[model samples]
Target: MLYRAPHKTAVDPDTGELFTDLLVIVVPDDSAKSALVEDPSVPFFTVPHFDGYNAVLVQESRLGEISRDELEEILIDAWAARAPKELVAEFFADQ
Candidate 1:
């Protein structure tokens, strides 16, 4: 899902435009810290203004640094976190 930051939190230093290479994924609380610690190589950061919010901003352009399987797992976890229970269950059943 596209997360429009309440304010412009991401700006490209070079082009000085809103960064287009970003993907905001909702996750469980405190997941951001663990995600960063788990893979420091991946550019993951939490919005300080969003202290209670459970989401992480990932550099979409840097996703290539991770394996396809890892990306799929991240996407699945994000989807399952917000998807309706029935839909999630159905999706897993088909898998």
Candidate 2:
């Protein structure tokens, strides 16, 4: 799922961009870890509050680092992580 930050929750260390202008996505734990490790060039970060939940904050300005297909995959995975199993199964079955 994607949501806008109500305040300046996250910031980009390099460019000083804030999360208030971006969208946060809740992903699977493995995916979150993999994104942090495998895609170090991308500025992905999280807060302590998100310790147990698998999520990451990304600056909208930095979205160029990921391709359209990658974004689509992330969105689908995020949705599946939150959606009911039956809905996810039906969604995939349609594909």
Candidate 3:
């Protein structure tokens, strides 16, 4: 399942300011969950549930503040690491 936090923040740079949205993705399976939690690149927080799933957080900032391409690449990398192949394919196929 996918979850999102209500918090939003902005990154400011010489060009302008960029707003970011936070998100959390919960995947089923212990190994995948562990892999995601261990990855240092993505910012994540563990949920309090006893289930094997984990929560991965990501932020979206403006192009001027931080390249949108880079932000999306980070999100995709984390999502692929945590989510099952089928789930990832399905999510992206629709988009």
Q: Name the candidate, 1 or 2, with the larger lDDT value.
A: 2
lDDT per residue (tens digit) for residues 1-95 in model 2: 46666455455556667546656788877666566635777666676656666877776777889888887888898899889999999999999
- Higher-lDDT candidate among 2 and 3? 2
TM-score per candidate, chains pooled: 0.70, 0.72, 0.35
Best by lDDT: 2
lDDT of each: 0.69, 0.72, 0.51
Per residue, candidate 1 scores C-alpha lDDT tens digits across 1-90 of: 454543476666577777666778777457644665356776666656546777777667777887888768777877888899999999
Compared with the true structure, the alpha-carbon lDDT of candidate 2 equals 0.72
TM-score of 3: 0.35
> How many clashing pairs per prediction, in order?
0, 0, 0
Candidate 2 positional error at 14, Å: 4.0
Tens digits of per-residue lDDT for model 3 on 1-95? 34344432323234344323545554445665676557665444353442444444434331234356855664576667767899999988998
